[model samples]
Target: MFKKIVMFLYVMNLAFVGNAFAAGQDREDGLPGMPYRTPTDKEFRVCADPENLPYSNQKGEGFENKIAEVLAKDLGKELTYEFWLDRQGYLRNTINAQRCDVIIGMGSDVDTLRTSKPYYRSGYVFVYRKSSNYNIKDWNSEDLRKGIIGIVGESPPTIPLRDNDLMANARPYRLQRDLNLPPGHMIDDLVAGKIDVAIIWGPLGGYYAKKAKEPLVVVPLPEFKSERNSFDTLKGKAEFNISLAVRKKDKDRMEMIQGALDRNQSKILKILDDYGIPHVPVVLSDKIGN
Candidate 1:
């Protein structure tokens, strides 16, 4: 469900091509020979996905869209977007390619971009019908073994699911799909009783659960340390801090964004609450690495 989230952090890093600029430049926009164009004072150019929701879409209805509006308003600039699909080559085609000045939301640990201070933190969650009365809060629950589970293939939760021997009864959904397609199908199946439970990213699960006709339960998984010598793909970290991103050379733009985020923090949080997004406190001491 959060293929966009995972791909943005891990896959996009491969698109970066190392660049060097001369030292002691007087410009705040770009140094003498920088590749990308700096953002102008008149417009806040944003790189965004046109169809992913709970995050972004063309209609400007997602929480990221709302947050972008807040930032742009605070910065005294008109908001504009370079719409792209959040898939492989996304960074190569958009921000890194110089199509936009900022990405409204990205994982804070992504090495390919200069990310701002995190605005919010979120993680994967368990979604099931409230009628089922399943009080599952962790991966060790016996109920998970008995029920048919739905999960996005290759996501962080899969590591624990496999370790618990629950893969035999689990159904996997595609992580990457066509650009025009939107998410929330797994939660749709859960509400229709096609699956007993859905283990998905928190924002996706929470938004869909709030929209479901039948009441659904959303439980956040507790943080756990990855075992030493473990070969799990995600290293057992389910939560992550999300931040705005700029080109590696755009430190000025990053600092400007950070100021806007600090000034409008409450408005941004209100937008997340209005969208039914589930979030956790961003604890710097417990920060996860790339």
Candidate 2:
């Protein structure tokens, strides 16, 4: 049922992003600079997760928040957030529905919205307690079958789990586990020995592993033979090249963001590195047509 809901949300997100036009001139949806002329609004309103650290938080500490500040300064706007948890209809409820104007980190593959050129690319990773001496890197590892693995439920990482029949013994992290709690709570579980291993999204896993109270092993998943890279393959529905998304009809807004992003690419990457995100170099030519 969770999977079905997520799939539905994915489809709806694409629809909302691709169309790009304002819903209705008669309907006011809680934002400015749409359905009319150039936006002179002084605020650069963003939609983000309040507790999803390493990505975003209300205090403006996440890498995305730093990047947003950079962009705001570049564009001469003030940064503001519409905080939402990463839950069902996140895209539909916030930016897509026009309750907010922008999202800093979204995959570029969604054809629904006009996404900025990807700023960076990353993949999933395997995180385990170093004290356990577990060094499994691939799903094909025999040790994986014997271990009590942790995975965020209904996420791309679960695909390899299902393919290998590892769900029965898995310690599944509910997608909406703790709204008030910080994101990537699984790493703490690993530290406490509540779980033997965790397959986590790269940014969260890499960041938390470095921040763990005790040493934890973090390994980027190897590319499956059938797939090109572990990150791209498992998250097959999308690429890891994260970008800012805007309503499609808002081409002017999109261009403004794209330019700002390009101008500050170096600073943005440094922020990501500080968060310990494992990613590939961005090919600007590919993200933006040369």
Candidate 3:
């Protein structure tokens, strides 16, 4: 599950064709331009999945898109995107390839890229119809086992489900899929009565629950310890701090991006609220697990 989450953060592929920039120009600060560095002084180039929403998309309807707009405006730069599919080779082909300068949303703990201070924190959530009146507050609730629970295959929430002996009641969905298709199908199934409940990422759960035809309940899973013998000693943190990311060596660009985030913090928080994105107070840390 940990590996899958990390891969999801690291391997989003974007498919875009834009004018390539010249590399190796000397900067006014007298530092040599890093290879494949975009002209950051004039543009806020972002690498994003063109179809992943609640996060980003080609239509600029996602919260990440909205946040990117705020940052770009605050920085006085034109916002441009390198649209890609969120799949294996994403970081390799886009940001790592120097096709863009930043990824609007990335887990702060991702070691492969230099990440900015987290803007917000979020986690997995339990989504059920408000009509069900289940009031599920944690993984141990007996109501969870009494109904069909939809979960992303190998997601962190599955650990608790297994620990509570609820696997038999679970319906696992694909963790990765074709980017051309819209997301939030699990919530769709829950709304249609195909599943009684869904344990999904907080952002997806909150966004889709709000858009569902009937009212839905979204409950965040708090941090806990894993009970599986193999992972007994490990702490299972459902929540993760989210931040912008740049190439590992691009400290200057990262500082600039951080400045933009700091300046427009309120606007970004408003965007999250408007989208119904479930989040908690930011914890400025790069460590993923203890």
List candidate 2 segments past 4 Å from native. Answer: 1-39, 96-99, 225-239, 282-290
Per model, state how many residue pairs clash: 0, 6, 6
Q: After superposition, how far is residue 17 of candidate 2 from its true place, in Å?
A: 17
Deviation from native of the Cα of residue 63 in model 3, angstroms: 0.5
- Cand. 3 TM to true fold: 0.84
Tens digits of per-residue lDDT for model 1 on 39-124? Answer: 67799999888888878899998888999999999999999998876665566556766768888876676665677778888888
lDDT of 2 by residue, 194-258 (tens): 88898777787889898888998888765433243354423423224567877767889898889
Query: In candidate 3, how many Å is residue 38 off?
Result: 5.7
Instruction: Quote each prediction's TM-score.
Output: 0.84, 0.76, 0.84
Any idea what lDDT model 1 has? 0.73
Question: RMSD in Å for candidate 1, one decimal?
Answer: 6.1
Ranking by TM-score: 3, 1, 2
**lDDT per residue as tens, model 3, 37-73:** 5466689899887777777889999999999899888
Q: Please give the range of 10 consecutive residues that has the lowest summed lDDT in model 3.
A: 14-23
Once superposed on the true structure, which residue ranges of model 3 sit more than 4 Å away at CA? 1-4, 7-40, 178-181, 230-234, 285-290
